[model samples]
Each structure stands twice: as structure tokens, then as C-alpha cells.
Target: MSTYKAPLADIRFALFDVLQAETLFSRLGRSEATRDVIDAVLEEGARFNETVLAPLNRIGDEIGCSYDKATGAVTTPPGFREAYAQYVEGGWAGLTAPERFGGQGLPHALGTALKEMIDAANLAWGNFPLLSHGATEALLQHGEPWQQEVFLKPLVDGRWTGTMCLTEPHCGTDLGLLRTRAAPAEDGSYAVSGTKIFITAGEHDLTDNIVHLVLARLPDAPTGSRGISMFIVPKLRVDRDGNVGGANGVRCGAIEHKMGIHGSSTCVLNLDDAQGWLIGQPHKGLAAMFTMMNTARLAVGLQGLGLSDRAYQNALRYARERLQMRSLSGPKFPDRPADPIIVHPDVRRMLLTCKALIEGGRLLGYHASSLLDVIEHGGDDDERAQADALLGFLTPIVKACLTEWGVECTYHALQCFGGHGYIAEHGMEQLARDARITTLYEGTTGIQALDLVGRKIMQLQGAGLKAFLELIEGFCSEHEGNPDLAEFVAPLRDKAGEWQRMTQEIGGRAMADPEEIGAASVDYLFYSGYVALAYWWARSVAAAQTSSQPDAFKDAKLQTARFYYARILPRTLAHKAAIDSGAAPLMALQADRFDA
Candidate 1:
């Protein structure tokens, strides 16, 4: 199997050259996040992920997580605990967390680069700490002072891990249908009773405690979503002084048997009146949970990007070495028995497809992460609000597009290896399997589509779309006169205009029939994603041209940008056609008559 290597060069280019994250940090008053510091963090992160986590990926897959039914304990694959200990010792758990809570106080954008490397090296292991970010966000935003005081530090210091327990047996997307119950205790805490399914890292021996942010309905609370309340239910109870004690009512009923990410424990968590504390306002759990969900969604997008890059790297390497039939043009390597498959046009198409999507998707995901810095530290209220708006709008797009593309890119990567790719030894199929979960979890592509069209576009008046379009216009206007950028600028500008018009049209149609939102949502999201990448690809080429980098790097950027525009961006045309078709054909098929 090909070894995992962190693409530090591309990561640097995306963060510094294209995004100008240093300037962003300076403007946002993140004085400690200097260029030198960021570089050091990235370098160390690369080393840790490549050396520590990457080696365990296949082992994690092969051994998986072992469950002890008697004790309700889940043991992670070998080397996982030691690697996690090293990760904690390196102070990576709280890299982007607030310093006041025992964190490094760095920018989220920098943390995103580190996360991509971690996911690429070992996606299953990365799942262990994934929800801790979201849980930290929830606590930071809504936890009471004492709760934060008690929980935040431990989570930041990596002494304990966290989980978001929102899904149940009956409901996955619709939280209103949940049946969890939370009853008040005399000591001012609550008793949370619920069975949360698909809980990642719910019960693990890696940490002394497992912090669960659970959704349960309280007594006298209203029915449906409004009745739901969030609670901090830990596997081991903790005192106000932050002392870990005996077990709470939380237990791992069973660990799921899955298709991929076998190393990551997906648990059926049974909280039988678990000792808990309420977070935020009464019956306002879902609103507070969004804090964690949004964070997780963005992280999930990074998971997709990481897997795509890993798959692409291996595919590219294989294509250059794997000798096959002679090139149709002629034998490029006549001295050898057969020319390398890289000489073939179709193979190049698949490889280029992965390249264009992975690179462009990198900029897209990183840019979204930078918005968090703005939201957290922008100089003015209006600036922060605008950043928040834009972040909200782009979240679903980033989550859905990157993950769906991950599946596509991995497929193309495996296809490049021919029959050998399908075998487990090559590890290509594992990536293919792993990539599938990113789209399905953290709100499926269809769910993200509905969120994009129904809520962000229609209900919120497309504030995020408007912010993104302004960015496109500003870039196009700034580069319109640059002859070097003329090819990309014109097309990007046109797409920006079409994006705005498309939003307006969807909004208008949704006003007449709500089903139009559902029908156009998935297609509209893909359309929006393609246009977003178009803007980023153009920016990448512009950055590469102006940088002090070598000619080869700049040339590759330009070539990839050209390929994206010529081949990948045209996908928006089909999506636009689907959107223009409206909801008539979809609803025309009756429920019972569908089988006919």
C-alpha cells in the first residue's frame, strides 16, 4: 500500500497564498497566530499525522474496534490509544480552542489544515475526536459558567472525549420525532434517558470519561422539537470541582457493524436516567445543538476532502508506475514492455477529475473555516454578522458537495488501478468505503440540499448567497483587466450572475409551491457548489501566478484550473436543467402507482 504523505505545499498555498489567512488573523486581532507559528503548527501536524496515524489506518480497518458486552466497554484498534496519547501530549486537541479554557487559542482555519491531514492519514481514528469539537462549541456557546468551568477544560486538555447524541431509533434527521426523556433531579441536575444510535466514539477506553451532549424531552415540555432539551450526560459522573467519579447511567448497549470506518466505534448508547445538567434555555436544545451540528458539518466536509486527496495521491502514483497497453498515440516507452497508464487519455481524465475536485474543494473548505475566525474575532459587529451569514449559507454546500465529490473521486481513483484496486490489500476499496459515510452522515446530501434551498435561500433571504456573489464580483472586477486571468474571470462572473438569478427563481417558485424547494434543492446545491469552486479555482490560478513558487507549481495550477472550467464546471449546466424542470415530474408519480 502507498504511504500517506501530507500535502504541506498545497496546504500552504491554499492557506497563505490564496486565502491570505495571516492577514485575516491580523485583522481579526489573533496576534498569536503569526506566520511562523502557523507554519510550525502545520509542519508538526503533518509529521504527527503521517507518522503516527497513517500507519494504523489499515490495522484499524482489519482489527476494527472490539466490544466487551459484559462491561459495555469499546476498545479501539491497537496503536490508536498510544497515538491519541501522543496527539494529546502534542497539544493538538485544543489547537483552535480558546486559551481561557486551556487551549492554544489559534485560528480555526489553521486547525482545519491539521484536521485534513488527520483525516487523510486515518479517517477512522480521526472520528474519535471529531465530535469533541462540536461538543466544545456547544459548551462554549451555551453551557453555564460552572458547566464550562467543569467540562470545557477537560475536553480541551484531551483528558476526556465528547459525543453529540441527537439521533435515535426512530428519527435521524427529524429531531421532533425523538422519544428521549429528561427528568429534573433534586440536586439541580437532570436525569437524561435516551437511546442514541450511531453515536461515534460513544464508549471508548481511550479516555477516562465520555461527555455526551444528549437531546431529551423534559416533563411538562411541549411536544415535538420544541420539547427537546440538551443535557451533558457523562459516562463517569463529575463533580463541580471537576473530579471524575463513578459511572453515570450511560452505557454502550451495542456497537454497530458497518461497511466502513470499522475502527471508529459507532455505538448504541443507552442513557438510563443518566446524571446530567441542562444546557442553555429550557426547551431550546435544538437551537443550541446547531452550534455543534454546524461545526461537525464543516468537519465532515474536511473528512471528505482528506479522503479525496489521499485517494488521488495513490491513484496518481499508481498511474505513473503501473505499465499497461501502449498509448494509442504510439508507444511512449518503447524500451519497456508496456507504457505507463498515465499516457492514456481516459486515465488522465479520471486523474484530472480527482485533481480538479480535490484542489478546488480544498480552497472551498478552507475558506469556509476562515469565516469562523471572522465570526469569533472580527473587528466590528456588522463584519461578524456578515461572516456568520456567509458561513451559514456555505455550510450545507461544503458538507454536501465535498462529501459527494469524495465518493466520486475515490471511485475514479480506484478505477485507475484496474482489477487490483478492488482488492483490500491495495487499500483503495477501504477509502472507497470510508468516503461513502461522509455523504450519508452529518445530514445526507438530500438533507443538505433541502437546508440550502428551503432555509438558507428562502427563509433567510439568501444572505450567504449574496455575500458569496459579492466576493465573486469583487474578484472579477479586480482581475478583469489582468490579461492573464481573462479566461477565468469572464466565465466566473457569468456564473455568479446566474447563481443570483437562480436563487431568486427558486425563491419565487417556492412561494407558489413548497415542494419546488425539495425538488430543486439537491440540484441547486450542486449548481451552487460548482459555481463556488469556479471562483476558488480562478483565485488559485491568480495566486499561483503572483507567488514566488517554482514555474512547475504555477503551471500545474493553471492547467488544473483550465481542466476544472472545461470539464468539471459544466456539471452545473445539467443541474441547472434539472432545477428548471421544477417539481412537476417528481410529484406526478403517485406513491402507490410507483410500483407499476
Candidate 2:
């Protein structure tokens, strides 16, 4: 597999230039959190991911993880524990965590950027702590004071790890059918009894304890998601003094052997009368759990960003190095036995394809993070509400499209490597394999699609969509005539037009036929992806123009923006057409039709 390097330059550029993320934090009144501080901290995180955690990415993939049934212990692939130590020791463990709990209290934008770095270096390994970060977020928002004091401190300090336990052997996407039960004790605690399957980082030896945020129905509560209550069930209970207590009721029945992310330790967790405590109010667990799920969904989108970067880097390096037939016009490298593969237009197209997604997607990913920072830290109530609404609307888009496109980015980037890409040692295959989970977990693309089409669009009687279009329209009007970015600006306006039409069509069709919306959902997702990326590209183009830099940076910026508009953005057409195609063809045949 190809060795990984942290893209420190591009990351810094995204922060300081395109998103002006540091400036956003500054405008929010956190003046102490300057660009210089953010840059230095991000640089350190890069090295940790590059030199510390990245090596184990392939190591774990090759050796895989181990589960010792006799001792009921799990071991990560070699070097993982040590790398985790370095990551925590570097003080990156608490980037976005609350300062009272020992975190640096950095903005969520920085946390999102840190996420991108780690995922690119080592996706499987990156997942371990990222999951913990999301768990901490959920607890901070919903957990009671005692629960926070008991668990959040250790988690923020990286003294322990965390996991989200929602899916079970019998149910996943539909939580209405979950069988787990949470019964309260007179002593003010609860007992959780049920089986949770496909739990990532569920049980591991890297930490003294694993704090699980689980969803289970209360005995006398209402049915479906409404009946569920969130709980804090650790692998091994911790005493009042924070010492490790006896084993909790939760135990790992077995770790799943999966296609990719073999080292992640997906588990089937059996909670047999497990001692637990409710994090939120009775029958309000789904609302609380969404705190973590939404955060994870956005992080999953960045995973796609990381995976795309990995694939692009490998394929770009190979294109420049690998030699083949001479140029059509003339040999670029006359002395060489064969021309470098980059000379091929189709190869250029593939390289450009990955670049378009990664670079543009990075802007949207980081922009959303900054919006989150504004939501948390901005001084004005109006600004915070605006940030909250905008972030909510885009989160699913960031989650669904970036991940879906990210996999395609890897697939195409890997394809450019030809036969060499298929080999394990080349690293192209690993990039593809590792990115596969970004779409499946947190919520599937289908679920996210339903969310965007069903929930986000209709929010506040189209207030969310109106607010978003206003922002995009404002940008297009201001930058329309600029010679430097006219090419990039025009397509963005065009895409906004496309989105308006698609939204109306989906809305009209779903009103007449409900299932029509479900069938067209994924396409709606891609259409939104196209529009989001277009907005970011316009912003990025503006960034490139405002910078008084050498033409190399300027040229590359405009070229990438053009590529995104001209090539990648056009896919929305096919997606829209497919959405308009409706569910008729897809659901036409019953199961018995195949048998016949």
C-alpha cells in the first residue's frame, strides 16, 4: 500500500483562505483562538496522523484485529495502542470538547479539519476515537450533571473510549422494531437487556473502559422511537471514585469479519441485565441520540473527503511515475522508454475528477464546521439560530453526497492505476475498501435521502430552502461580473436553478405518490450534493482571486473550480433524470419474479 502524508498545506489553506474559519471564530468573539494557534495545532495533528497512525492502517488491514474469547478481551492490530497514546498525548483528544472537562475548547471547525487529517492517514484507526468524540458530544448536550461528571471527564481526557450502541441483530435503519429493554431501579439507575449488533469499536483493550450510549425502550413507555431511552452502559462499570468496577452486563459475543475495516472490531454486543443509567428523559432517547448521530453523519462525510484524498494522492503519484505509450502530438519525455500516464487525457480526467470532489468537498466540509462554530460561539442570537438552521440543512447533504461521491472518487481514481490498482500493495484497493462504510453507518444514503427530501426541505414551511437559496443567490449576484471567476460563478447559478426545479418536482410527485419520494430519494441526494459543491467552489474561486499569489496557486485554483463545474457538476443531470424516472421500474418486479 502507498504510504500516507498529511496534506498540511491544503488544510491550512482551507482554514485561512476559503472558509476563513479562523476569522469566523474570531467574529464570534473568541479572539484568543487565532489563525496562528489553529495552524500550529493542526500541523501537529497532521504529523501524528501521518507518522504515528498511518503505518498501522495497512498493518491492521493485513493482520486484522483479535478477539480472545477465553479472556473476553479484544486486541487492536499492532502499533495501534501506542499510536492512540501519542494522539491523546499530543493533546488533540479534546479539540472541540468543553474546557471545563480538560479539552482545549477549540472550535468545531478545527475538530472537523482534524477529522479529515486522521481519516486520510488511517481510516480504520481514525474511526476509534472519532466515535468517542461523537459520544462525548451527545452526553454533553443531554447527560445529567452526575452522569457528565462520571463519564464525560474521562472521555474528553482520553482516559477512556466511547461507542454508540443503537443497531441490534434484528433491526438497524428502523428503530421502531428494536427489542432492547431498559428497566429502571428504585436506586435511580437502570438495567439494559438486549443484543446490539454491528456496533463499531464496541469492545476493545486500548482503554480501561468503553462508555456506550445505547438506545432501549422503557418497559411502560410508548412504542417505536418514542418509547426508547438513552443510557450510559460501560463495558466495565466505574465506581464513584472513577476506578474500574466489575464487568458491566454488556459483553461481546463475537467480532464481525467484514469486507473492509477489518481492524475496526465491529461487534455483536449482548447486554444481559447490564447495569446502566439513563442519559436523557424517559421516552425522549431518540431526540438525545440524534445529537451524536448528526455529528457522526457529518464526520462520515469528511471520511469520504479523507478517502477521496487518499485515492487521489495515490493515483496522482502513480500517473506521474507510471510510463506508457508516447504522446499523440509528440513525446513529452523523449528520452523515456514510455510516456508518463498523466499525458493521457482520460487519465487527466480521472485525476481531475478526484481533485474536483476532494478540493470542492473540503470547502463544504470545512464551511459546515465553521457554521457549527458560529452556532455554538457566535455572540448574536440571530446569528446562532441562522447558523444552527443552515448547518442542520447541509449536514445530511455533507453526510450523504460527500460519502457517495467519495467512494466514486476512490473507484475512479483507483481505476486510473489500471491493474496495479487492484493489488493490495499498491494501496488503491485499500482506499476503496476503507471508504465503503462511510455511507452504511450513521445513516444509509437512502435514510439521509429521506431526511433531506422529507424533513429538511419542508422545515419551517420551506424556510430552510429559502434561507439557503438567498445565500447562494447573494454570492452569485455579487461575483457574476468578475472576469477571474465568471466561469465558476455562472454554473453555480445554473445549479441553483436546477435544484429549484428538482425540489418542486420531488415535492409535487411525493404529494401525489408517497413511495415516489422514497424511490427518488438517492437521486435527490446527489442533486443536493451538486448544488452544495457549486456554492463552495464559488467561495473558493473568490478566495483564490483575493489572494495576491503567484499564478501557480491561482491557476490551479481556477482549473480545479472549472473542472468541478464543467465535469463533476454535470452528473446532477443524470441523477435528476433518474429521480424523475420514479419507482415504477425499480419496484416493478416482486420477489417471485426473479424465481420464475
Candidate 3:
């Protein structure tokens, strides 16, 4: 594995130059998040990951986590707990959490950048804090006053860990089919009885307690999803004074044996009449859980971004160093026996693909986080509402596309290694293995696609898409006459128009037959994602053209923008075709006749 280094330069460029997050932060009243502070945090975070976490990436994969069945406890791979302690002591767990709850209250955009570094350094170790951050978001949004006071502080303080227990052995995607039940007790608490499988960071020895945000059904609740309710179920119950008490009725039945992220414990949590309290209103669990899920989905997208960048970095280094064959034209290194593989166009193609995706995807991820800052702290309600809508639409796209690209980029990175990539010792194989799960968890790519095409576009009448399209159209119009950017501006305008038309067509078809939504969903998602990245790429090109930065930096941005449009953006054509195919081909075959 190549030594992981935080891409602070790109992160800074995205924040200060491309996204202008500093301006957004200032406008949002995040006064403490000055450039100095953000930079310092990023630099320190870089050091932490480089010196501490990066070394553990391979170790985590090799040792994995050990589960003690007798005690129902999970011991993370060696050095995992110590690294976490350093992480907590560094005040990283609450980097963007609420100030009232002991967090530094920095902008989430900064946190998102830091998170990418940590994830790239050690993805499995990153999960522990990742879950806790998601849990904190849920509680901050929906927890009761006392619940926040009792649980939120510990979580924010990094004294306690957290987990989201949603999937069960029987029900994975369909929460309506969940069998968990929560019965109210005389003391206003509830007994949560269910078995939640595939719970990340569910059982770990890193923290004093694990606060599980559980989803279950209450008595007299409606059937299916409407019946579900959210609960605060802790592994070790805390008293009113915020002191850890004896074990609640929660235990780890077993940890899963997984292909990747071996350091992060995926547990089978048995909540046998566990004492719990409702976080949000009764029977509105899905809505409350979404508070956390949305946060998680975006973070998961960054996981994809992180892994892809890491793979690219290592592969690029290897390609430039590994001597393979003479260039078709001539040997770039006349003194050497053979030129480095980087001299090959195919290798350049793979490297450029990774670079384009990571840089462009970084913009998308940071832009989403910037919108989050607007939603949380922008003064104008209308702007906040618009930002909220756009963020919702981008969330699924960012999650699904980035993750899918993670898989693709890793494959390219591994291929660059030749047969050496297949060997375990090279670390490319681990990157490939770990990238597989990003698309699977935090809702699968298919689920995110359905949500995008079905809920965001159809049910919401494309409010999110409309807001985003308007921005794209406005940008294209602003730069339409500029000769230098006319190439990008013209194509972006056409695609934005096409995207709007496609959405309207899909909406009309779905109105006639709801199945049309499902049929066109995945393709619609990819189309939207590609177009979204195109807009960001255009913005990047504009930024590069006008900037005072070194020509090297500006040239890289312009070249990548060209590559994205020339090579990657055309992917929208195939997706649009697939979307136009409609439900006929998809639903033609019967369930039992799939084999035919």
C-alpha cells in the first residue's frame, strides 16, 4: 500500500476556491470557523491520519476485529482502540457537532474534508466515529430535551460511541416488514425487543457505552412503515445524572464475517426487552431515522471518494516508478532499460479517470456540505429551503455515484498494478475489497436510485431537481458568450435542458404507471449525477481560468474539466437511453421465469 497522504491542497482548493466555503461559513454565522482555524484543523488532521491512522490500515485488515462470544464484547484490531483514543482526545469526534453539546461547532464542510482524509487513511477505523456522528445528528434533530442532555453530551464528548440499528435478519431494505416491537412500560420507558443485524460499530470496547438509535413498532401502530418508531436504546443504561449504569438488555449475539472493513465490527445486536425511550413522536420512526440516514448517506459517499483517491494516489506513484515497456513513440527514460508505465496512454487514461472523478467528486461532496451549512445557518428562509431541497436531491446521487465510482476507480487502480495488484501484499486488493461495501450499506445504490426518481422527482414534483437545474442553466447563461469556456458552457446548457425534459417525461410516465419510476430509476440517478458533476466541473474551469494560482494548478483543473466533459459526461447519453426504455422491458419477464 502506498503511504496515505491527505490531499490537503485539493481539499483547500475545493473549500476556498471552487466552493468558496469560507464565504459560506462567514455568511452562516460560523464565526469561529475562520480560514486559519479550518486550515490548522486540516493540517493537524492530516498529521494525525498520516502518522497514526495510515499505519493501521493494513494492520486492521490483517488482524481484523475479535469478538468475544462469552462476554458479547468486540475487540477491535490491535492499535485500533489506541488510535481512537487519540482521535477523541484531538476533539475530532465533535468537530462539527453542536456547541451546546461540547462540540467545536465548526462547519460540516470542514468536517467532511477531514473525514475524507481519515477514511482514506483507515476506512475501517473511521466507521467508529462515523456512526457516532450520525447518531449525534439524529439526537440533535429529534431527541427529547432530557435525551439530548443525557446522551448527546457523551456522544459528542467521545466518551460514548453510537450505532444505528435498522436492518434485521429478516428485513434489510423494507423496513415495513421489520419484526421489532417496542412496548411502553409504566415508567414511560419502552422495552425494545428485536435482533438487528449488520450493525456497524454496534459492539466495541472503545467506549464506555454504545447508544443505539433503534427502529421498532409500537402497539396500536399502523402496519408497515407508518407503524415504526425511533428509540434511544443504550448498551449500558445511563442514569439521569449522566452516569453509566449496569448493562441494559442489549448484547452482541455475534459479529459478522465480512469481506472488507474487517476492523469495524458489524454486529448482530440482540435487544431483548432492552429499556429504551422514544426520541421523536410515536410511529414516525422512519422520518426521524432519516435525519441520521441522510447524514450517513453523504458520509458514505465521502468514504467512496476517500478510497478512490487513495487508490489513485498509490497507483499513480507505482505507474511513475514501475518500469514496464518502452513507449510506442520513444523511450521517455533513455538511460533506463524500460520506461515507466506512466508513459503509456492506457495507463494515463486510467490515472486521469481516477483524477477526474476524485477532483470533480470532491466538488460535489463539498458543495453538498456547503448547502448543509446554508440549511443550518443561512439567514434567509427561502435560500435555506432551496438549499435543503437541492441537498436532498444531491444526497442520493452523491452516495450512489461516488460509491459506484469508487468500485470503478479501484478496479482501474488495481489494473495499473498488473498481476501485482492481485497479490495481498500490494494493498491494492484491500482497497478493492473495501470499496465494495460503500454501495451496499447506508441503503444500496438501487434504493438511493428509487428514492431519487420516485420520491425526490415524482412525489416532490422535482422541486430539488428544479432548483439544481436552474443553477446549472443560470451558470451556462452567464458564461455562454465566453469563447474560452464556450465549449463547456454549450454542452452543459444542452445537457441541463435534456435533464429537465427527461425528468418531465419520467414524471409523466410514472403518473400513468407508477412502475415507470422503478424502471427508469437507476439510469435517471446516473444521468443526474453525471450532469451534476458537469455543472461543478464547469464552475471549476471558470475558477481556474480567473484565478491567480500557478499555471500548473490551473492547467490541471482545466484539463480535468475537459476530460470530464469529453470522456465521462457522455455517460449521461446511455443512462438517458436506459431511462427512455421504460417499464415494458423490465417488467416483461415473470418472477419465476427470470431463469429464462
After best superposition, candidate 2 residue 527: deviation in angstroms? 0.9
lDDT of each: 0.94, 0.84, 0.91
TM-score leader: 1
Q: Residue-wise lDDT of candidate 2 within 1-596, one digit each (tens)?
A: 77777777777778888777666777887776887788787778877888887878888898888998986677999988898888788777888888998888888888888899888888888778877888898888898887788898889989888999999877888898899998887767788999999888998878888998899988897877778888888888765446678889988889999889877888889999888888778889888788899888999999999989988988889899999999888899999998999999999998888888888888888888888788888788998888788888888889988898789999997898899889887888988988888889999898998887778775444555666888899998998788877877777888888788778877787787888878887888788888888888778779877775567887887888888887878888899889879888888899789888
- Give the Å shift of residue 322 in candidate 3: 1.0
How big is the positional error of residue 149 in model 2, measured in Å on the Cα after superposition?
A: 1.2
Candidate 1's C-alpha runs over 4 A off are none
lDDT, candidate 1, 1-596, per-residue tens: 74689999999999999999988899888889999999999899999998999999999999999999999999999999999999999999999999999999999999999999999999999999999999999999999999999999989999999999999999999999999898899988888887899999998878989899999899988988889889999899987777789999999999999999999999999989899989998899998799999999999999999999999999999999999999998999999999999999999999999999999999999999999999989889999999999999999999999999999999999999999999997899999999999998889999999999888988899999899999999999999899999999999999998888888888888889999999999999999999999999999999998887899999999999999999999999999999999999999999999889
Q: lDDT for model 2, please.
A: 0.84
lDDT of 2 at 570: 86
Where does candidate 3 stray beyond 4 Å?
none
Q: Report how far off residue 450 is in candidate 3 (Å).
A: 0.3
**Residue 531's lDDT in candidate 1:** 96
Error of 1 at 115 (Å): 0.3
Residue 345 miss distance in model 2 (angstroms) = 0.5
